[model samples]
Target chain A: MNKNASRFLAGPYIIWMIGFTVIPLIMIILYCLTDGDGAFTLANVAAIATPEHRKALFLSLGLSLVSTLICLVMAYPLALILRKRNVGQGSFIVFIFILPMWMNFLLRTMAWQTLLEKNGVINGILSALHLPNLAIINTPWAIILGMVYNFLPFMVLPIYNVLIKIDDDVINAAQDLGASTAQTITKILIPLSLPGIISGINMVFVPALTTFVISNLLGGSKILLIGNVIEQEFTKGSNWHLGSGLSLVLMFFILVSMALMAKYDKEGEGTAF
Target chain B: MEHPLIDLVNISKTFDNTMVLDDLCLSVKENTFVTLLGPSGCGKTTPLRIIGGFEKPDTGKVIFDGQDITNLPPNKRQLNTVFQKYALFTHMTIAENIAFGLKIKNKPKAYIDDKIKYALKLVNLDGFENRSVASLSGGQQQRIAIARAIVNEPRVLLLDEPLGALDLKLRQDMQYELIRLKNELGITFIYVTHDQEEALTMSDTIVVMNQGYIQQMGSPEQIYNEPENAFVADFIGESNIVPGTMIRDELVEIFGARFACVDKGFGVNRPVDVVIRPEDIDLVEPEKGTLTGVCTHLIFKGVHYEMEVTTPDGFEWLVHSTDMCPVGKQVGIHVDPFDIQIMNKPESEDEEAVGVNE
Candidate 1:
């Protein structure tokens, strides 16, 4: 048998990418460049400078950046603990972290809304204890909370994978060479886990930037993020060209992050999880 | 009297219901090279880890210069380790790896640079300062690991099979290099390995272990010439060990023949084990020899010829000679009285068949 013949098994994946990914992206680009009557115009893309669109874009960037930073600060320590325990890859502890991923993401976000609402489970308990109500249900704080809760495992799993792959002898070697625990973490562990950190930042930031559903549920429909505006242009406004143009703008941010990831993680070792 | 530089006093360790170290004790002298020689899983590494502060014994204490340091962490200890795998930092250049200890101590820039240069020069890798650790070969990486450890000027250096990954030729060459390093640096070196030749060639003292127990600890000559039991005799080199009976002081009997021997102190008619080295047997004409046998097999070793001779009484003997004898040829074997060694059989299962010589 010809060994190379097995390569043709990738044919279906190539077709799937062309039909679902490549064609949709090319169609979005074409729609963004042409008006309804097939006339060339830059008006739709140029509309990003409008006050409302500009405010939405800056707010989206700020909130996502904050959420990504918080996730990093939270995930690195948890990954370290998991690796130190020498937990098996299929341990129940890892399953507990990944269990939330199996539940519908929307359901999890809605559960957070209930817990943060004035008359919901958390506030009911708080009122019984004479504590102040959590009024963050309809604020940007709730949206940021939802983003962090939903995307933390995305950060944890990849960083944990990288941490577990580090040889114990290397850590011992560092300590054997007179590096204190803090120095070892900063000089050896952090530098070695940089690929996972970069991948994690990309994973969290992109989704948190492009999410319209979390804001709609937790921040109320009144807060118009760039994702909300683009979604409205497609659904209510029936302005496909404007929607496609704004999507192209969002993609520019995603592409920039991707380039950053490529620079730090050339081998894609951190992207597996 | 001065205390030994490092002492492992009655240490014991167990992992998941299996005992790895059983009340082992060792005292290492200052500026001396000692080797822990054993087969894998024989608990040789546990002592090194206990000394390096990477492991804590379940019982007993580790004393350094008369100070109890059993609870100290690795970074706070005065010892350094060259791990089995070298464990060089892949993210850093060679220079940064060697300067890591000095940098942690906040040494001045000029001092750190001079030390880095000096350390690399000591390892004979003077110009590899900027290369990434991954770019170096296994031998180079091993040298860099040595440089990284020795730059700290630790009181004692622990090495856990550092030459395990090299080829035989390179391993031999590096053995001499390590001996030179130990002499020049004048630091106590505690090395671990299963290679008998390596332990014999470099170490001033060899500690032989088996099944979580020390079988013997002595100079290489003592370990080779006067093994305490049958296990030590069999593990050290090619030997012909046979069951014998001591008829009286300085007399023994084997193969139903009475032979005069230089060993004593065993009771009359006491059963014992006798060891004779292969090279110690001399080939002579059948009529002039002490015992006669027909050569059954012959092989030409690089330095000598090894032949298997079998007596008419069914005793098989291994002999090393400079000349070859044809198969089925009758040959006479002679032995000197001093060349025979008598030992008591091991009393327990833990100490069995564990000796080696170069």
Candidate 2:
């Protein structure tokens, strides 16, 4: 088979990527750089400095950052425990962690909203026991909670995959070479599992940063994230140009993260999914 | 001898109701190169792991330098192991892999650098400091693993088939290199291997094991020439073991002919196993020979011709000689009384036993 003819096997996938991913990105760029009259101007992109948009962007950044941090702190130890248990990738233990991902993501976020509401299940139980009502709904804390709940598996899977692939003999060699348990974890395990950690960070942070549905369902449409503002622009206000300009700004962060991923995970070592 | 450096007293281990090491005891002297030689699943590696503190025997005490270290973890023990696969940290450079133990001990940068240089030089891998471990060849990686273990200057060094991955030539070269290193460093080395020639080439003491039991422990020459039983005799080298009867003191009968021998203590008319090494048999004129046989087959064995001589009664004798004998040619085979080794028949049938004594 000649090389040119053999390349035809990927024809459908190439066309799909270009049509769905590349073309949409190009259209968003064009919209971000032009007005409704089709005249190119920087005004749409610069409109991000407006107080409402700026506040939403910062809130999204803060809430996503907190959610990513919590996911990392919670996921690392869990991944390490799973690896220590010698759990296979398709084992019931891993299936439990992935079970939540099987549920519809919006339903999961809405379920959290019900739990965090003033008279929700948790608050009702608390009041019945003469405890204080569970209070942090329609706030950044609830949004962060929803983000963590929805995306925790994103942090666990890659780290677990990487950890499981690390050779047991390497860890044994480290210990035989006089490394304490703490030193072995830091010097051997962590350094060896870096690709997975970076992948997990990218997975958790990207989704948490761009989520509008969780904020809308749990934040009562009051605490506006950048995603919510963009949603309103596209759906309610019918401002595609401004929404695309903000999306372009968000894409810049995503691109930076992708560059970091390329640097750390060139071999795609942690990509189990 | 000198006070033992490491003593594993009555060690026994079982995994899931299957015994791996059964009441095994071993002691090592300081600066001696000891080898545990056995076939696979003979439990050779378990003892090495126990000494390195990687495993705890289900029922035994590991005593090092007269202090009990039975419960010590690998990190707490003053020992290091070169794993079967080398196990070099792929994330680190060669220099960093060799410097791992030193860094953990919090050695100064200058000292660590000097130690790394010395270790690399010792392993003959000088100038590989910045090279990544994954880039090195199998032989080079094995050398780096050796350097990594030796850099710590531990009291004892354990190697678990460290050269198993190398080619034949590299394995032979590393065998000498390991011997030289042991002499230069003066650290006790406990090596585990299933290769008999390797065990003979490098070990000061060879402990032959079988089915989780020590078959024999001796110097290489003793193991080769004076095997204690049929198993040791067969395992060490080639031998022609024949069933015979001990007629009287210093006499044995085989093929209905009497032959003088050196072994003793078997009662008259008692059944015994008689061993004769092939090289010990000589081709003589038919009338001057002890037995007459026809050459059945011949193979050129580089240094000699290995001829199978069949006696009139139909027993085949494997003979190694520089002089080639033609097939079907009648010849006389001579044996010296000193070359015949008589042993008692093993109590149990060992299907794998194949060697004869000389």
Candidate 3:
């Protein structure tokens, strides 16, 4: 193929990307500078410095961080098991883990709400078994459980990709050289698969932070997060300026976190993908 | 009076209905080097893994220093393996890689430092301690692997084609270095390789295997000169096998001519396959030879000349000579009587006997 022809073929997507993504991002930055009275002012930016907005931002960050930790804890062993089993049922096993992803996001969230309700299947089973009835619906734990279920596959796949590619002989060599199983895992396997773990965490944390549907549906709208706050400003409050400012702040936080991750990945200078 | 450091008795392994190793038995005396030499899938590496405790034999006992470690995990076994790819911890530095085994044992810092220093020096990689392993050359990484395995001072060291990845010249150099290290460390080294020259160069004893069974086990000289069967003779080196009949004790007939060999105990007129190395067949002027042939091709191999000769009986023979012999020149081939190896012909009608009378 000629170079000119290839350039022509790439032109449309380049224009589309600049128009749809970059132009809108520039517009958002400009909007952050303008106030509700159509004047460029610091008041709109200063409004985001309020305690309620800061609390919501911190809550979102904390929730995302916790979700990432939980996902990592659950995903590492699942990835290890999938990598080590060496059976022909890998596809089936992966499907069982990922089957929840095929359903609509709202439906899955509603389903979790039904399952965690006060009179849901879980409480019904407890009552039938003559145990004290416990209420789990409309709680932070419910939100966490819902997030973990929705994002567990994303966490597992990347780690599994990295773990499966690790040379078995390397592990065997470690063992043969007198490394106990625990030492082998801590010293060899984990460090080698750090890139995968980081990628999996990013995949789980970024989406979990911006997810309001699961939290609102399962937490009974009592727990307000950054996503819920942004939603309220845009739809109910009709405060476009505040909503846009909060959106920019949320995006800034995500970008900063991602930049830190990228820096760590660079410093580690090991396999990432 | 000391017992062998490692002994495997009747070890066998079957994988999904395929016999990877069958009734394999080997014994390694303390501080001696033994090589498992065979083609790929001939159970050479399976035996090494079995010894290293990375694999378990279906029905066998692995004894290390008179202890039955058949059921022991690899970490508990007193053995370390240098895998074919080296399997160095790419995330660690050269020093860390060497100190890995010691660290696992929870050795003190001072002791690990000294051991790492000593092991690196043994492998001629002393100053390379802090360097990242990924930056080193392939040969250097291979030496690091050796250092890593030997730093623990295990009772046995298993090497699975550790030098197979190196170029020919580096591999040859490592072969001598390995022998020197073996002598210096006095640890039992169980080396595995498919390269015959490597086994012949480094091993005190060579075990030749094929199709999950040991074909022969002997010194390099014995394996090269007096292979027990056609498989060993063919596998160990280049050989010219001719179908012949044992006319009497120490005599065999080949291609309408009776020749004398050193082997005996075969009944008169019994069918046999005669094996002779190319170098053992002496060439002379065509008119004054026991086996006369016209040279069909000549390959100049630096130190020696290899010539293919077609004999009067249409048998092709390979003759190795240090002297110049032109193609199409008639030559006489004479093999030393004691150099001829005779074995029973393979029991197959489609099997063609290899003749080296080129």
Candidate 4:
């Protein structure tokens, strides 16, 4: 309970932050400012102006925005329905949503690839049904699907938490006031749940924007997102400067989204857990 | 009499295998305050919800203004409720909250503004239009809720214990405020509460309920003076209900002593419940009264002394008097014939238990 003991309890966390977070950020900035000869240069950061890099960054934005929108469209109704079911936490409905999260994220994305690939389970089902062959794999549609599938829970959970907390009396009062169901949802429910909506958008948009794994596994090498561009710079290209520069840019977007979250969700009422 | 503004005819409701309301019937006159008074879980709220269209009676019809609206949704009903907890929309402003019903009805902007202004003035919360709901206190929020409900000019306003959250002084003030508002608006008000004093003070007709059954319904004075049975007598006031026998017209036997009374519907030596209010008993010298007892305990109530006197027959009498009686003092109790209320004795312990659910 004493101040000195509490500070000591934070010793490990402080050390970990300084070593992993603070040091890595500083090193990334340092690497981003230097060239192969260790001389200061802006070429790596300036490479974002190039056509290929520009296309990748814009594609990343477009796809993530589409995925985030799709998640919102899907998650809000799902959350509303689940809340209306009135089953408390630890119910089977919630487990059905969270069960997939228990498996490894990579394994889930890879499983999606297996299902969507040509002559895969879905195509095989279509063929058995005597339907035409279907193909959406190795495209931006596949990448967006992967992002939405992986991050949909982040959207559902916060919205569901907020929806569950809204007092039944409030809804009843709305009805008693002669507001139709549609009017009540528009005027009362949506505005009250705005905090959760914004937070869910933040949760879904940030990771989907920066995800290399989903694009890599689902879209194959044909697609090059900002994340893929930065990733290849680090892995196959062996250019830490270029990769770190792009990560810094990605971190800027993350920081902006975090600031947006802070502005809208100051109380963290939308915190899913 | 003209047809009642609202009629709940033979209503019955069951919740998860438990009977909540059992064939209840009630009628409310226009422009009068009707209070559904009962303890919790006695189905007082179910009737209010049914009127507001938030609930449906399992059996029977809710006729509002001679039209059956039993299956209508709340939004389609021509009434509003001031919820028990003042369920104000926290996301809106005071003005916005009051304007909700009007806006939902698609009222014109100028008309809505005028109504909002009038509603706020009625609740004595003028100049609070721009204030957010979160910025107001509980009492103020409750006023806003009232303003919100009244703005739409519904035929009936169902208040489900609206003032139950306030302190005693504030509740008393709001009770008078509600009366004034009802008089000014000339709309029927259906109030629900378990507070007997509140019902006695504000209601034009009080329907006392116990275990989903209407124990009695009448004007406050009638209910206080002539209760139907032991349940109404005990629930309304702290009456000393003692078992006695009705010997004949204008006479009853209480604790081996014959007392003059005005009630005599029952003939012969029929058993009855003799209802005597605590404040009605006057203590005097032992030889000068009909019955005598020793003061067992004395509690100094704010304005009067509450003395518990135990008679020789072991029936403890609760007496409220101005003069203090010392503990263990022998006291004589006298009652006027008008104060002696008599009713048939409860048939069995099972029925009483089922009625009060004690």
Best by lDDT: 4
Q: What class would a CAPRI assessor give candidate 3's docking? A: high
DockQ of 3: 0.84
| Model 2 lDDT tens row, A104-204 | 99889889988888889999999999998878999888998999999999999999989998888899999999888889999999999999999998998
- Candidate 3 per-residue lDDT, tens place, B30-132, comes to 9888999988877789988888888889998988888999989999988889999989998899999999988888899999999999998999987998899
lDDT per residue for candidate 3 within A1-273, as digits (tens), equals: 999999999999999999999998887777777887788866556666899887877877888889889999999998899989863334788879878878898998888887778898788898999998777677778888888889988898878887887789999989988888888999999998887787788788889888888878987878888899888987999877777778887887788767766865664333332
lDDT of 4 by residue, A24-123 (tens): 9999999999998999988888889899999999999999999999999999989888888986778999888888888899999999999999989999
lDDT of 3 at A81: 92
Give a tens-digit lDDT track for model 4, residues B170-262.
999999999999999999999999999999999999999988889899999989999888888888888989989999989999999889889
Question: How far out, in Å, is residue B220 in model 1?
Answer: 1.2
Off by over 4 Å in 2: B283-292, B311-316, B348-358
Deviation of model 2 at B151, angstroms: 2.0
The digit string of per-residue lDDT tens for model 1 on B1-358 reads 6569998899999999899998988999999999998878889998999999989999999999999999999999998999999999999999999999889989999999999999989989989999999899999999999999998899999999999999999999999999999999999999999888899899999998887888889999888877777666676677888888888888878787666779889888988888888998888899867789999999999899999999888988999999888899998888888888888765655444343333
Candidate 3 Cα misplacement greater than 4 A, ranges: A1-3, A87-90, A119-134, A266-273, B346-358
Sort every candidate by DockQ, greatest first: 4, 1, 3, 2
For model 1, what is the C-alpha lDDT against the true structure?
Answer: 0.90
The TM-score leader among the candidates is 4
- Give me the overall lDDT of model 4: 0.91
Question: Best by DockQ, which number?
Answer: 4
Rank ordering of all candidates by lDDT, starting from the highest: 4, 1, 2, 3
